[model samples]
Target: MAGTNLKCRECATTYELEPRYVCEQCFGPLEVAYDHSRFVDDVGALRRRIQGGPQNIWRYGDFLPLDGPPGPALRSASRVGLPAGCTPLLRADRLAERVGLGEVWVKNDAHNPTHSFKDRVVAVASQRARELGFDTLACASTGNLANAVAAQAAALGLPSYVFIPSDLEEQKILATGVYGTNLVKVRGNYDDVNRLCTELSGEREGWAFVNVNMRPYYAEGSKTLSYEIAEQLGWATPDRVVAPIASGSLFTKIAKGFEEWLELGLIEGSVPTMNGAQAVGCSPVAQAFDAGADVCRPVKPDTIAKSLAIGNPADGPYALELARRTGGAIDAVDDDEIRAGIRLLAETTGIFTETAGGVTTATLAKLAARGDIGADEKVVIVITGDGLKTLDAVRDTFESYEIEPRLEAFEAAVEQGVHV
Candidate 1:
């Protein structure tokens, strides 16, 4: 009653907190359900504790499901967790103007240690895995999660196995392997890898598949993003938040974070509407939204936004319900628009993001153009990863001019309208 428990999102069946992510009754996804009565009646003390704690997600430890004090793991002669959150929330006036909005902000999560928001989830998963007596950790990743899990496992000195699609970005593959974890490349897509991991999870004992067995704890990590955003925005919630959808967990977690804040009296006003973006080539959730269907039909992914290419999203139905309940819309854009989105964000905010971020940015523009998002509303676009990881997506989208190191040659190139 004091701590947390696993609650079925569908049947409301509650179970004792354990290394489980799915309910036995309805086979629904399990979520961490905290007893709000444990929180102190004094909001000021809570606020001060959060503000004065570590400069990371641990500052909000009370909100997370962990044993004892929720701190980072002391491994590799250093700390391994607690540094994955507290990313900057930049006031993107330039981006807002370009998107025809009165105000905009970018929750730049690329600043995480692993250069993606996955670090937050992996940090918690690694810690929880160790606490649950797991000496090895594993997951089925697209790209960013592989980099994050491998890096975090290395830092924690735990043997890790990451299953990824064979055709993931070279940068992601190299980065993940550099962590020295066992990297498995499947010939099939992410869904196939995920299925294999699920099978492996049932076969292997003491191996905590972060996104499988320890998913409830792992997913709780994403709530820190919403907490950080509200704290950075003067303890207020934004009117809208647009995030790219892969499995749709992050999107729903953001909404849940805001609701928790309101329940705890940590923030005022209603929760923000949740907008989701996806690449057209792999947009099951967005397609479901467009067709007014509650179920998402899986599609074969063929987009440069590989990070957001989970065709069979586990949280697709919940994400769709949240979007509709909040009066928000889900949309998809083609590869060209995704590339243009990356350029537009870079030109305006100087933040180069991965193709998933590009999808979110471009979708924001599309929503703005259609007057779906009001021009006078305040919006925050979530940039989930750094552009450096997916450089191939933009390799042919821009060009640089070569000139001799002479003043005349430079002048000639400038006269020819060469990009500076």
Candidate 2:
């Protein structure tokens, strides 16, 4: 494995790469540390090797925290589960025009197997779980992770337990339940469910809670989004990245991915301006960034963007630091703006993204309206999940015309601008 050990982000303490996510000495988050000496020596060969590998994230296995080489045998076996990454990075010219930007791209992660970016994290965490001799897969999710964990576990022939807020979207609940996993819905929000899962992780043996005990490995999965963006852009980084912040993991890890590639000479460009998006109802990270606070003050979530409703974001401070260091900002949008964002992206780019993506799109628009983005800057806005997951958000947002299947009725309705 290129990943050597788990290193504390705060104290720099190291530990063996087991199912650990926090440092005992400083209680800071632990992340996978790598030794890329071999890849550094042959950048050209490394590029060739990556291009020649599988279409999924396994192509970038060298950067991921895997136990052994992602050789033919391992790749073939891993194919049994859902393969994530390599989603489209489309140039949204119309969207750019709408936002008054010069160049804009959309990293539509909703194209994944589970229709969300959580598939990428679940794939990596579940693989590491199997490597560590865990027999079951589990997670406490906002919505998308529940669906991804259940589907991946089913594909891997592993028994799984998924915990989620009882009030999650019915679409997500139905999607997850279809996979035959044990779905447990607690009577609280995402944070409450996460707390329960954390306690259960310690009590339940032979269980791999992907976002808890296995979080260090799980969080590394988000880095693949950046890897794909750079590779798809012909090995170049964009001028800015606008991605939604849930637990702040994905937002920060995307920057980490660019840093790793730049250090290894794989991609050419400085780290992009990191703009973090959030719903006004659950904008702890944005609040901290706006207030110039070192720590986030947790808030109770009350947003339609349920997928990004993490009140107390674990990586809040790190996300704030990254935004400030990169000369970017963390902005929050209200539900009305979120809904407008969803409609704007779909109309302009033809990408129907979930509420999380709405938050991102609206934030990007806010930045553009404020002239925060330069006219010639290349920006990438990440759409985390498909719009279908949050169908209610678009309900009654637009009007539908009903005709009596007659040309006269259609003509009358069209002329009157109302259904008759």
Candidate 3:
């Protein structure tokens, strides 16, 4: 499908694709409704087109909402490449050995433009911002989203305004601010900042809130991760996927990505299981899943995995659906587990993931322990952000172990098998 109409998910009523996000008829959430039959007519051609196109996520433009040939925004996207969607599908042999899995891979998105996979979604969001005639782009973020919004908007020549919690990582806060955007630090947690942003959207007219109203298309960007994973695995879907749970959007959208690829015949097999991983202190969705609830109950944040601390995730219900349909599991890990997960990943795979990735690894460990993930199953764990970004979390857990410019001390430490 070249373009799509919007259909309400709840009522099945259709609407024209406009700037509106919600259904005017039934007040239901509107989603992109593609002409699937027509879109599937040339799946091979679609694959060839994507293979021959630029390296960014827009290589699959035929699947997106673009109205014509690649526009100026798309051209710019291509030139930069951002090396966005084509991140490494690293085979974690060491990690597999530790976890006792026959096959395990890490989709390392920490290498993105702003040092997180948020760039993929935010890239599409920023492009949509320019396409929809908005001069300013904005979002409510705990950390990663803020960094992405500032960087993408700045790169795209749009004024950016990021609203973030005051208790966010100092590195993340400074990273966004250094982009020279308008960074507003709210004195509460992420949920509070999100609430404020939701209210402000009503008052702001020309501003495009990327994660709010511009979110539907913005969320579509996350599908690229799943798309890449499938393609990298030789045009077949994996057996399982474990991803960090933030607003629950990423995990749900990644599953959607694989589903769309299957529907469009981009992949030859059925979609993989989508598992959700969360930090224990901020795991509202995990609690809901554990309790067999339909929706996640909101809670106050209390986790070092600040990036995944969205207690009131918007896509929690969808996440539950994805996991249940894939026969996957969702679980949470405590702060200590998160830290150990990070260390385990770093030691085994040479990927320095923040606590969010730690959550995924820790949950993957738990899933393996519960015999949920099979030894021979092909599993992909997403590492969203770099560990160095949240130095505070693991600061005391690690130290320099400096030896005062002495070879003798280094020899002693080496003999002791110590981290020097």
The candidate maximizing lDDT is 2
Q: List the residue pairs that clash in candidate 3.
A: none
- Model 2 CA deviation exceeding 4 Å by range: 69-80
Winner of 1 and 2 under lDDT: 2
lDDT of each: 0.89, 0.94, 0.82
Model 3, position 116: C-alpha lDDT score: 93
- Ten-residue segment with the worst summed lDDT in candidate 1? 73-82
By lDDT rank, best first, the candidates go 2, 1, 3
lDDT of 3: 0.82
Report the CA-based lDDT of candidate 2 relative to the real structure. 0.94
Tens-digit lDDT string for candidate 2 (1-420): 879999999999999999989899989999999999888888999999999988888888998898753454554433448888899999999999988999999999999999999999998999899899999999999999999999999888899999999999999999999999999999999999999999999999999999999999999999999999999999999999999999999999999999999999998999999999999999999888888898999999999999999999999999999999999999999999999999999999899999999999999999999999999999999999999999999998998789899999989888999942
Order of candidate numbers by TM-score, starting with the best: 2, 1, 3
The list of candidate 3 runs beyond 4 A from truth reads: 68-83, 412-420
Q: Regarding TM-score, does 1 or 3 come out ahead?
A: 1
Q: How good is model 2 by TM-score?
A: 0.98
Model 2, position 382, has a per-residue lDDT of 95
